[model samples]
Structures are given as structure tokens and as C-alpha cells.
Target: MELKQIIQNRRSVFPDQYNSKPISKQVIMELLEAANWAPTHKRTEPWRFKVLEGETKINLGVFLAEKFKETADKFSEFKYNKIKRNSKNAGAIIAICMERDPEESIPEWEEVAATAMAVQNMWLTATDLGLGAYWSSPGLIASIGEFFTLKPNEKCLGFLFLGYYDGPNPERTPNPIEDKVEWL
Candidate 1:
């Protein structure tokens, strides 16, 4: 597919739409390679990925459900069950993290922006490969570092859920770009 179409057609495909088939490790590597190529100021390369597959994915589900239960003032069984079910069903879960520069030479927001760009690259590549992908930023995501044992400077941004799907790709109707852009 052409780059323009790929960008325009990219949609958040949910885990429920994914089929039961497993995604090849080689394909996942390609997606990571694409993410690696995203532009970063001063070559900081702050973005980091923790891939959870097979049994690890199951553990992630349990962790997320338990975290939600512990954090919520009034936990709903429905929400807890949904979170667990989705994590268990996903083909893979990638924990997106940003490793802050120890010296603090550059602003932290720049590092986050660079990480987001990296995720965008991965998303586009997933679209090209006909794989279902979605970036989820739940409130409990901030506490992921505790369970994942992330380094002191490393902070969890969110997670990218991935899988294979044969369902219809939903069409997106974005508002006019002109409204958001300003003349120089």
C-alpha cells in the first residue's frame, strides 16, 4: 500500500477483532526495526520496548487486573474481567517506555515525543503488514514499571496490543487539518 493510504487508513484495531493465530517473531522484529528508525534528538533513542508473549502475556493480564483492583476505590467486577480477558486474548503486548537521559541535557518532553514517533512508526508498519495494533494508555499504565522491574530512570508510557485479524477495517473521518494548522 502507498504511504499516503497507509497513513490515512490506519485505525485502532482492538484485540477482540484479532484471530487466534500467532504472530511470527520475525514479523515482530520488523516492526521493532521500524520503531528503531524514528528520529530522535541527539540520538538519545529513549524509547524502549518490553515484549510479552505466551505465558508472559498471561502474567501481564493477571498483573493488570490485580493492579486495577487494588487501585480502584470501588472496583467493578466487569472492568476487572474485561482487562484480564483482553490481555489474555492479545497475541502480544509491548510495554512502551522512555529511559530518561541521566545527564538531563535535553528536555524530558522531547524524549516522550521521540518515543511517540517511534510508536507511530511501529503502528504504520503494522498497518502495512495487515496486523491489528492499538496503543492503549490506561491510568494503571503508570504503575507498570513496578511489576516490570524497570530501571529507576525508565518510565512506562503505555502498551501496544498486537494480533492478527480478518475483520473489516473501520473507516476514519478525521476533521479538516486546516482547522488545526496555523499560517506562519
Candidate 2:
């Protein structure tokens, strides 16, 4: 498919049929390569990713579940279990982290924006490959100092789950952009 068409068609899919089938490492590498091409401020590419699969994905699910159980005062057991279960449903999960460029002296927000662009690149690549993907940010992901272990000044942005579609993409009716544009 053309890149432009893929970009327009990519959708965040969460459905009931996702199984344990695994995506090959080569495809995952291609996704990262696409992300590596994203534009960044002052060429300070700040996106960091940890791809979790096999046993590691299970461990991550358990870790997130336990962290929520420990830290969320009002945590629902159902939600915790759902996260654990769904984490295993995807073929793989990519942990997205962002590190600010200390030498560049740019505003932190720019780095975050660049990181988002990186994720979009990855998502588009997945779409072109007919892979299912979604980006999710639980509250704990943003607070790297909390449940996740990170180097100084590093922050967890979110995780992207990728797999072959278990079912058809849901019908999407995007909100009309008539009220979302401006012309000077």
C-alpha cells in the first residue's frame, strides 16, 4: 500500500480475538528503523524503545500488574488482570522511553513531541505491513521514578502493542475536521 494511504487507514485496534501468535523479530526491526527516521528538534533523536516478547512480555505484564496493585489505592483487580492478560495477547510490546537532550538546551516539550512523532512512524510502518498496533500510556508509565527502573533523566512515554490482526478492524467514523482547522 502507498505510504499516504497507510497513514490515513491505520487504526488503533483492541479486539477480542488477539492470541499468542508472535511477530518475527525482523518485522520488529523494520518498525524501529522507521521510527529512527522520524524528525527531531536539532537532530536530537530522543526516542528509546525496549521490545518485549516471549517470557519477557509475561514478566512485564506481571510487573505492571504488581505495581498497580502496590501503588494504586483504588485500583480495581479487574483492570489489573485485564492489563496482564492483554499484555500477553499481543505478539510483542514495545516500551517507548524518552530522554531529553541535556546538551541541546531545548525545551523538554520538544523532545516529547519528537518522541510522539517517532511512535507515529512506527505505527505507520506497522500499518504498511498489515500488522495491528496500538499505543497506550498508563499513568505509571509517565512516572519513571515510580514502578519502572530508569537511568537518570529518562522517562517512560508508553508502550506499543503489535501483532497480526486477529479480526477485522472496527468501523471508524472519524470526527469531522471542519471545526479543527484554521486558515489565515
Candidate 3:
């Protein structure tokens, strides 16, 4: 497919939409490789990905469910159940992290933007490969360090929940680009 077509077709397919079939490691590697090519300012290359699969995925679900139960000021049982179920349902979860430049050579926001572009690349690749994916940034990621080890310079950005789904998701219609543009 063409680039424009791939871009237009790329949509956030959620956990409930994902079938039970597992996406192979090699395919996941392909997406990661595409992520590696994302443009970086000053070559900081700040994105780091940790792949969670099988029992690890289930463990992550349990961790998030328990943490949400303990921390949310107004948590719902429905939300808690969904949080736990989502992780275990995924074919894989990529913990997206950003490693700050040790010397602080660049502004922090630049590093963050670069990391996001990296995820965008992976998302596009997944779409092209006929796989489903979505980036989920739950409030509880602030506490993820408790569940997973991290370097002093590293922090959790979010999780990329990816899998293979069997059908179409609801359509997302974007507003016209012209409406947001300004000419001086």
C-alpha cells in the first residue's frame, strides 16, 4: 500500500478488538526497527522499548489493577476490571521510555517529541503489517517504576498495547486541516 493510504488506515485498535492470536517476535522486531529510524534532533535517539509478552503481560495487568484499586480517588470496579483485562488480552505490550540526555544538552521537550515520533513510526509499521496497536497512557504509569526497574535517567512514557484483531474499529473522522491553519 501507498504511504498516504497506510497513514489514513492507521487507527487505534484496542484490547477488546484484538483476537487471541499472537504476533510473532520477528514481526515485533520489524516494528521496533522502524521505530529506530524515526528522526531525532541532535541524534539524541532517546526512545527505549521493553517488550512484555505471555505471563509477563498478565503480571502487568495484575499490577495495574491492584495499583488502581489502591490509588484512584474515585475508581470504578468496571475501570479496574478493564485495566486488568486489557493487558492480559494484548499480544504484547511495549513499555515506552525516554532516557534523558545525561548532560542535559537538549531541552527535555525535544527528547519527548523525538520519542513520540519513534512510537509513531512503529504504529505506522504495525498498520502496514496488518497488525493492531494502540498507545495507552494510564494515570498509573507514574507508579510503574515500582513494578519495573528503571535507570536514573529513564522514565516511563506509556505502554504500546499491540495485537491482531479480526474486524474493523469505529471510524475516526478528523476535522479539516484548513480550519486549524493560519496565514499571516
What are the per-residue Cα lDDT tens digits for candidate 3 across 1-184? 8999889999999999999998899999999999999988889899999999999999999999999999989989999999989998899999999999998899999999999999999999999998999999988999999999999999999999999998775588899999999989
Instruction: Give me candidate 1's TM-score against the actual structure.
Output: 0.96
Ranking by TM-score: 3, 1, 2
Worst 10 residues of 2 by lDDT: 13-22
Candidate 1 global lDDT: 0.91
Instruction: Report how far residue 78 has shifted in candidate 1, in Å.
Output: 1.4
Per-model TM-score versus the true fold: 0.96, 0.91, 0.98
Predicted candidate 1 versus true structure: per-residue lDDT over 1-184, tens digit per residue:
9999899878999887888889889989999999999999999999999999999988888898999999999999999998888788789989999999998889999999999999999999999999889898999987787678899899999999999899678878999999999999
- How many steric overlaps does candidate 1 have? 0
Q: Please state the error at residue 82 of candidate 1 in Å.
A: 1.0
Off by over 4 Å in 3: none
Clashing pairs in 3: none
| Candidate maximizing lDDT | 3
* Model 2 per-residue lDDT at 45: 94
Alpha-carbon lDDT of model 3: 0.94
